[model samples]
Structures are given as C-alpha cells and as structure tokens.
Target: MLEYAPAPESRSVVQIAPSYGLFIDGDFTPGKDVFKTINPASEEVLSEVALGSPEDVDRAVAAARRAFETWSARPGSERAKYLFRIARIIQERSRELAVLESLDNGKPIKESRDVDLPLVAAHFFYYAGWADKLPYAGFGPSPRPLGVAGQVIPWNFPLLMLAWKIAPALAAGNTVVLKPAETTPLSALFFADICRQAELPPGVVNIVTGAGDTGRYLVEHPDVDKVAFTGSTEVGRQIARSVAGTGKRLTLELGGKAANIVFDDAPIDQAVEGIVNGIFFNQGHVCCAGSRLLVQESIAEQLLASLKRRMSTLRVGDPLDKNTDVGAINSAAQLARITELSEIGTEEGAERWSPECSLPDRGFWFAPTIFTGVTQAHRIAREEIFGPVLSVLTFRTPDEAIEKANNTPYGLSAGIWSEKGSRILAVADKLRAGVVWANTFNKFDPTSPFGGYKESGYGREGGRHGLEAYLA
Candidate 1:
C-alpha cells in the first residue's frame, strides 16, 4: 500500500459563524436555549446552534401552516422555478456545502463531495422537473398538496435527508417544518440560506433545530398534515405511535441489519471490494449498510482472507483528507454503543479482527472491525450496530443463505455477489430486503426509490413514489 501525503481541504469557502439560530418565517430567530455543534473528526467546536423548545416547534409549524395556503395555491410551473433556483444554488456552492458536511457529519470529504452533494443536487433537480408534471405523474387529473409537512431527519446524511424531505414537499406545493438531528445541524442551517437566496415564500420551508423533544412536538402538533421521519426503528415506532390517531400522513425510513452474501462463484477480488464498501463507507453510519456477511462455506476461507487483506489498506483519519477512506464515528454516544456491542460479541465467543491503523488522538473514533464465528442467535448478528462493524457467518447452500438473510426483522437492503446470473436472480428473489444489489453495493440514485420492508419501516424516498408521501 502507498502512503499519501496529507491533503486537507481548505475550509475557507465555508464560513461557520460563532452561532446559528432557528430558521423560521424566512429568517433566523433566537431560541430559548442553545447547544454547541462540533466537528466529530477533530472534536472542534464549529458553531453554537439553537435548541428549539416546544414553543419554537409550535412557531415553525405555524409558519408552515401559514405558508401552505399561498404556496400550495401557486401554479406548479411557478413552484418549479423556485426548486430550479434552489438546485442551481446547490450546484454553484457544491464545494462549500460538501466541505461543511464533512466537517459537521464526520464523513470523508470524497464521499461528501463526490457522492452526497451531487445526490443532494440531483434530488432537488429531479423533483424540480416533477413540480409541473404532477398531472402526468399518474396521480389523477388534479393532485393536491398536503398542508404542512413536519419532517425529522437523522444526522447520518443531514443535507441529503433534508433534501429528501423538503424537495418533494415543496415540489408538491406543501410547506415544510423540518427538524435536523441535534448532532449535525449545520448543513440544514446552510440550506436555510439557500432558500433565502431563491427568495422562497416566507414559511415555505422552516427549519427547527433541536433534539428528540423538538421532533416529538413537531410530530404531535395537530396542525401538521404530514409527518416524515428517518432515523432509528425505535424512534420510528415512537413517531408512528404519536401520529397514529392524529390522521396525519406518515412516512418512515428506518434501521436495517442488511446481509451481504458471497457465493462460491463470485469474483473473489471484486466481492472483497464490495464487502469493504458495503460495511465501511460513511464509517458504516448508513442505515442500509451491509452489516452481515453470509459467505458460502465452500469459499469462506478464501473470501475472509481477501476481505481482511482489503480491510488492511483502508485509510482511517481526518474526514477532510481526500485520501481517508473511513472517518471518525459520528458521536461519543454512538461510539460507546458500538464498543459495547462489539465487546458483547467477543464475550459471546465470536472472534473479532481489525486492520492495524493509526487513529487520531482527538474526536470519536472506532476501528473498522469484523467478527467471525457469529451465529444467528448472537446479538451482533441480530441487531443493527450502525457502525464500522461486520459479522461473518457461513452458509452451506443458497437455501441456507436465504434463510439466514431473511431471518432478521430488518429488510432494508441485501447484496448478492455471484458470477452465476441464475443463482443471483434466484437468491435475490427470495430475499425480503427492499433493495438488493446483484454485484454492486451502496449505489444510490435520485430516480430510484429507496426504502425498506418489515421492521425496517415503511414508505419510500426518491423516485416517483417519494412524491406520494406529500400529496393528497
């Protein structure tokens, strides 16, 4: 492996102020309390952000309800123009947003720049085209926008999740009250600036920043016509219960313990790469991350050897370094959870292994690790670790692999790597996951719908199906 020189991205383009306020009614307002936002990579304080109280949530929801009457009545063509302007601004400031996202979210600059920011822009652009074409979108002659959409997004992909929630809501002519996750709220705050640049209608998009209490208040608010949430399945269930009798529309993108199966006929080299990308990308913070590896017993040894060799070369360090493959863990609490789970896996008789890599002294960090000899009953295999951890298990045949893969309650995603097309198709058909990648993993597109089945939660984001969540 070659050692690359440190190449840190300049942060000059992003001007993080000393503090930020709640974005409501087309402006920033002081909140009752405030919390600090930090860079997970360096543990550096980035900005002080407002912590929205219940009253603040009420204020944001009121703003959205007020904006909806006029915004929803606007011609779809006019709504399209605003979305186009937002998209253009995102593209123009892509570098700045990308850098800011990496700093706030602890994801590699390469992914924040190349993957996330592009998708963020594409989602808006894709939905922008749909704004004026709803009549042709198979939703009947005159589809109507839901009134006020109250959305809560996770920190894993803050800006992108914001786009997923806000774009369709706006394109469908509904106003929005979005609450970004507390740990990473800067990107969404910056997005508030973009809305201002587009001269969007006051209260058309209101961002209330805070923790669980804030999101709970928004979801339980009587005036919010629709609720969209993306986070833990536990929290998803809470949101579901909270909005049950309210008659508000709900869409949830939740947790997963996806299985990545490797057959004997798979291209071992490429399969190894896919496995690495599956579990380690974004420090394995992805909800759809492939965390379980069910390898065919016939080639299990060879695959593990190659997989470990590949893991050895992964670069883990500063998120801003272009060459860094794995970044810091998102927060201290998440790191503790990951550590506790991995320790339990070891105590339960599973074997753990990690590549020899130097970690930064500051910030929350966890080494990319894999466990062998894991069984279906093991907690590590059954639960969603949501970190850079993989559990390896062996399967005797395709039937056995399918049985183990479907055993979990999560059905978010799965991966099948095989040279035999028939076997790949046959196995994929049996997997209960919502998204199954035949040879590749972690690939996403705005035009493709993404979601999960079973306990992983319901409804879809992206593609034409995403629009249904905000429409009447």
Candidate 2:
C-alpha cells in the first residue's frame, strides 16, 4: 500500500469575520448575547456569533410575518427565478462553502465537497423547478404557501439540512426564520449572504444563531404558522409538546436506529461496502445511520472479519485533508455521548472492537467502532447511537431477522442485502422503517422523500410530500 503525503485544502477561500450578527429582515442586527463557534477538527475559534435572545426571536418572526404577505403573493415564476439564482450562486461558491462546512462541522473534506455541497445545490435546483408547477402536484387546485415557517436544523449536515428546510419553504412561497444549531452556525450565516447575493426579498429568509432556548422561543412564537425541525428524538418530542395545542403546522426529521440486514446468500463484497458506508459515512453523525447490523447466522463470522478488515483501512484525521475518510466528532458533548454509550455497551455484555488508529491531540474524535455479541436488550442495539458505532446481531431465519429489526421504537430507515430478489422484497416489505434500501445503502436523492415513523418522528422532507409541509 502507498502512503500519500498531506494535501490540505486552502482555508483562504473563505473569509471569516471576527464576529457575526443575526440576519433579520435583509440586514445584520446585533444581539444581546454572543458565543464563539469553533473548528471541530482543530478546536480553534472560527468566529464569534450572536445568540438570538427571546426578543431577537420575536423580531425575526415579526419580520417573516410582515414579508410573508408580499412574498407569498409574488408569482410562482418570480419565486422560481429567485430560487434558481440562489442555486446558481451555490454552485459557483460550492467549493468555498464545502470547505467552510468541513471546518465548522468536522466532516471529511471529500464528503463535504463531493456529497454535501452537491446535494445542497441539487436540492435547491429540484425545488426551484417545482415552484411554478405546484398546481399539478396533487395537493389540490391551488396549493398555497403557509405564512411564516420557523425551521431549526442540527449541527450534523448543517448546510444540507438548511437547504432542505429553506428551499422547500421558499419554493412554496413561504417566508422563513431559520435557526442553525449553535455548534455549526457559520454555513447558515454564509447562506444568509447567498440570499443577499440573489437579492431575495427581505425577511423571505432570516437566520438567527443560538442554542436550544432560541429554538424553543422560535417554536413557541405565536406569529409562526409552521415549524420544521431536524435533530434528536428527545428534542423532537419537546418541540411536539410545545406545538401541541398551537395551530402551527409541524414537520420533524428526527433520530433513528436503522438496521442493516445481511443475508447468507448476499454478495459479500457489496454487502460489506454497503455496511461500511451505512454506518461510517459522515462519522456516523447521520440521523438515519445504520447503527444495527442484523446478519444471518451462517455468514456472521465471515462478514465480521470482512467488516473489521475494511474498517482498518479507513483514514481518520484532519477534516480538510482531501484523502481523509472519517473526521472529528462534531462537538465535545457529542463525543462524550458516544463514549458513554460504548461504555454501556461493554457493561451490558456486548463485545466492542476498533481498528488501531492514532487520533489527533486536539479536538473531538471517535474511531470507527463495532460491537458484537449484541442482543436486542443491549443499550447500543436499542438506542440511537448517533456516532461511528455499529452493533452486530445475528438471526437464523428471515422471520427472526424481521422481528429483531422491527423490535426498536425507531422506524427511520433499514437496509436489506440479499442476492435473491424474493427474499429482499419479502424482508423489505416487513420492515417498519420509512426508507428501505435493498442491496444498496446510504443512498439519497432530492426526488425521494425522507422521513421516519413512530418514535423517530413524523412528516416527510423531500419530493412532493416535502412541498406539503410549507403549503396551505
């Protein structure tokens, strides 16, 4: 094997200001309190960001509400043009934004550049085409935009999530007040700039940076007509409770403990690749990560061997390095949670394994880890371990595999790997998850609707269904 030297992407492409203010009504406004956002890979403070106080939330919502009357009244063709302009600007600045996302969110530069940014641009492009065509979207004759939408996104896949929330809302002619997670707020601020460059209407899109309190305030704000959130199931529950009696329409893309099933007759190589991509992509920060591996008893030994061998070759280091595979954990708190859950897995009698890899001295990092001898009762198997951790369990029959896979409260996503079409169809039909992948895993498209059922939360976030979230 050849060891390649470091080829780090230049950080000079992005110009980070010393501090940032909240984006409200097409302008940057100062906030009462401010916090520093850091580079998760190096633990260096990238910039100080304003924390939106309750008053700040009120102001932003007021701005959105005021603009919604005029913005929503605009012809769908005009809305489409604005969205297309934003999409073009995103494509032009994709590299710079991808680099900024890698720095802020600790995802490998390769993924940020290849997967995240392209998807972000594609989402806007897809939704942009839908703006003028909503009448035929099967949502009734004249599907109308909901007034002001308050969207809250997580730190993982920060910019992509922002695109998911903002694009659909704007395309549907609704104005937005979005809150990016505190840990990775830079890209959203950058997105505010993109809106400016496109000359988007004032208050059509506003970004307020802050912690959970700000999100709570935005969700509770009486003026918001719709609320969209993507994060932990626990936090999703809180948001659900808060919006319970309010007439605000709600959509949540929350947590998952997805199962990746491997059958005895499956193609071993492809299945192994699918399994690795399922759990290890984005350092397993995915909400729909395939954290549980349900393999047939006959192939358990061979599959585990292949999985471990493949994991050993993964490069875990600087996020900005073009060759890096896995990168740092998004934050110290998330790293602690992953560590504690892995500890509980050991205490609960599950076997743990990781490749021998040296971690950097600074920043948050968790190696690719997998647990064997895991049972349905184990914490690691049941809980949403939103990190680079996988729990391996074996089943004897297709029925048993289905039973074990559906045993959890989560129903976000699942994967089935089998060469036999009949068995793949049968197993997929029985899985409770909203999204199922057969022979392939971790695949996403803007046209395909993505969401979950049961404790994983409700409502879809793509395709025609996504338009329903922001539409009247």
Candidate 3:
C-alpha cells in the first residue's frame, strides 16, 4: 500500500507557558492548586494549569458583576466595536490558536485550522453585528442584557464553543465568567491575551480552569445571572436542578445520538461519504454527531460495503501531520469509555468491525469503528458513545426510518441522504431533531441557528437565535 509521507504542521507557531493562572478581572492570578494538561497525541505535558477554587470563582463572578455595571451601560455600538476587534484579532492569531488547540485537544490540526478557527472567528463577527441591533432581533422591542453570564464549555470543541457562548453574551452587553473544560484549557487562556490586546474592559471576560467542582462553583455562584452549558445531559440535569428557581436564564446543549438515514434511492457514493463525515469527524466527539446509521434495507449491504472501504482509508496518526485524517482520542478516560462501550456492543451480539489501521503507541487512540446488525434496543445504538463509533440499523420505509430515528430521547441533529427533495423535506420535518441536513453532514455556519430538542437540551445557539438567550 502506498503511504502518506509525514507532513506535520510546525509546533513553533504556539508557545506554551510552563505554568498558567486563572484569568480574573482581565489579569492572570494565582490559584489555590494546579493541575497539568497533557498533549493527548503524544502524552506530553503541555502546561500546568491552575485548579480554580470556589474563591477563584468568587473573584471571577465579582469581577464580572463589577464590570457588568459599566459594560451594560456601554452603548450597543461600543460593545459591537469590542466584539469586532476581538473577531479581527482571532483571525490574526488563529494559526497560533489552531496549533495550540490541536496540541491540547488531540484533534487533527487541519480541522482546527480549516473548520474550527474560521467558524470561531465567524461567530464573533456574527454576534458583533448583532450587538448594535438587539432591539430588532425579535426578542423584544427593547431587550436587555442579562448580567454576569456563567458559561461552562466541553472539551470537544473548546475554542469554538467558547466563541458560541461568549460572543453572544458579550455582544448582548453582559459580562462573563467562563470555565473551559479541564482537558482543553490552553486555548481559552490564550484567548485571554487576545482580550488584553483588544483592551477589553477588566472583568468583561474571565476564564477559570479546573474540573467538575470548579464548573459547579461557577455555574452555581449566586452572582451569575445567566448560565450556559455545553456537555453531557447528566450534568445538564444537575445544572437545571441547581438553577430551578434561581431566575437565572439558562441554555444547555447536551448529548446526542443522531441518525443519518440513507434511503435506497440515495446516491451510494455520497451517502457513504456523509456517513463517514457525520460519525468520524473530530473522532466523533461532537455533541450532534450522527452516531446512528439508518439505512433502507434494499441498499443496506451496498452502503455497508462502501462505508467499510472508506473507513479503511482513514489515516489515524500524529495530529500535527497534515495528511492525517483522524487523530488521538482526547484523554485516557474518554478512550476507556469508548473502549468499554465498544466491548459491550460485541458482548451484546452486535457485529463489530474496524479497518486494518495501525494506531500510534505513545498516546490515547482508537480506530474508526462500526457495529452492524444493531437494533434500537441495543445499548450501543441508544447511548451516546461520543467516539468514532457508528451503529448501523436497517429500515424498510421512510416512516420506519423516522420511527427509529426519533425513538431516542436525544433530538440534537440528524441527516437524510435521498436525492428526492420531497422525501427529504417530509422526512426532515418528522425526525424531531433541531437541525437536519440533506445530502451533507457536519456542516456549520455562523448565520444559522443550531441546538437540540428533548433530552438533548433547550435553547438555540448561532444566528439571531443565539442573541435571545443572552438578552432579556
């Protein structure tokens, strides 16, 4: 077999500090304790990060509160300019940020460079334009900013998720205290420098880094007026209970087990490609990844063959390698979860398969995988694996496909692969998911709204809808 020669993005683009501190009140401050964040691709210790304590959260919220008074008092146009400046700075420093993201997050550098960085900048640019036009955003004639937003983002898409929550909240004139996921804290910390360069007001944005307890401290802090989270549904439930009557506006983008339904009439080649992109992109760490494949029985065999062939071709190696298609799993714990779930799939009588691909020995890794003969009753088909694993099930009719697709509690995102426009429209409307795509998978834009239904959580992010959550 012909092999791809190593073509790695230079690591020199990013400069990692030996130790990091919490960004509170527009400055880096010492924390009570600290932890190390490692590069998952090489298992190399990237940097030491402060483990934020409740006191740290306190300072962050207090800073946000103090800044909120003046921040909320700023003219919408002034806030827009700040957001615009931040957006421009992100573009200028994107290469550094992208390299840092790949090192810390274990995602392929190409994704961080091409998809994640561009969208991160676009989101800021999108919300910046909305800063001065909140009254016309359909929220109300004179919408108001909810003060001191507390945001918790997941490790899957660190910088992009930060942009999703912070851009809108800041644009709506609310200051923020954000806790980036413990595994991916470097990029957010680097973003603190971008804020300094933009000369944003002190306390306008604060980043506290730590594990679950620190996140709990930030979200449960009384000073927070709004709470936004993107992570597992289990934690979303806990946040809902904590904020039950706190009067804090909340939005949660949780887990998903989306179905990519490919009909018999669908183009075989395109459907195979979409299936790969849907489930394997970002190693399937996405919240709205199409983990479930619902294919018509008539074309099931053909689709499986094509999908296996394509999956075999996916390169899994060094994240910095430009030719690598898939990279390392984010962490050892996440890899264990994927491994356990995949083992259970085999024990439960589902046929498991993976392409003949060798993985790196030094760090966490998993080959692209799929489960055939899967039924909805199987746990692998029902639960969110959150890895590069796909569960394939067959259906005879469009109604059957929709039935299987909407059967789960998750309603985050789904896709259809039929060329027929009428069938696509009808099936999409009935799938009970927040976002549906036809003939494509894993596409995102700043102008479009994205969210989920049912246990996948509530409220929308992106476009005009995103501004509503931050505005009162």
TM-score, cand. 3: 0.99
Ranking by lDDT: 3, 1, 2
TM-score, per-candidate, Cα-based: 0.99, 0.99, 0.99
> What residue pairs clash in candidate 3, if any at all?
none
For model 1, residues 323-423, the per-residue Cα lDDT tens digits are 99999899999999999999999999999999999899999999999999999999999999999999999999899999999999999999999998999
Model 3 lDDT tens row, 150-185: 999999999999999999999999999999999999
Compute the lDDT for candidate 2.
0.94
lDDT per residue for candidate 2 within 40-112, as digits (tens), equals 8989999999999999999899999899999999988889999999999999999999999999999999999
How many clashes (backbone N, Cα, C below 3 Å) per candidate?
0, 0, 0
Q: What is candidate 3's local distance difference test score?
A: 0.95
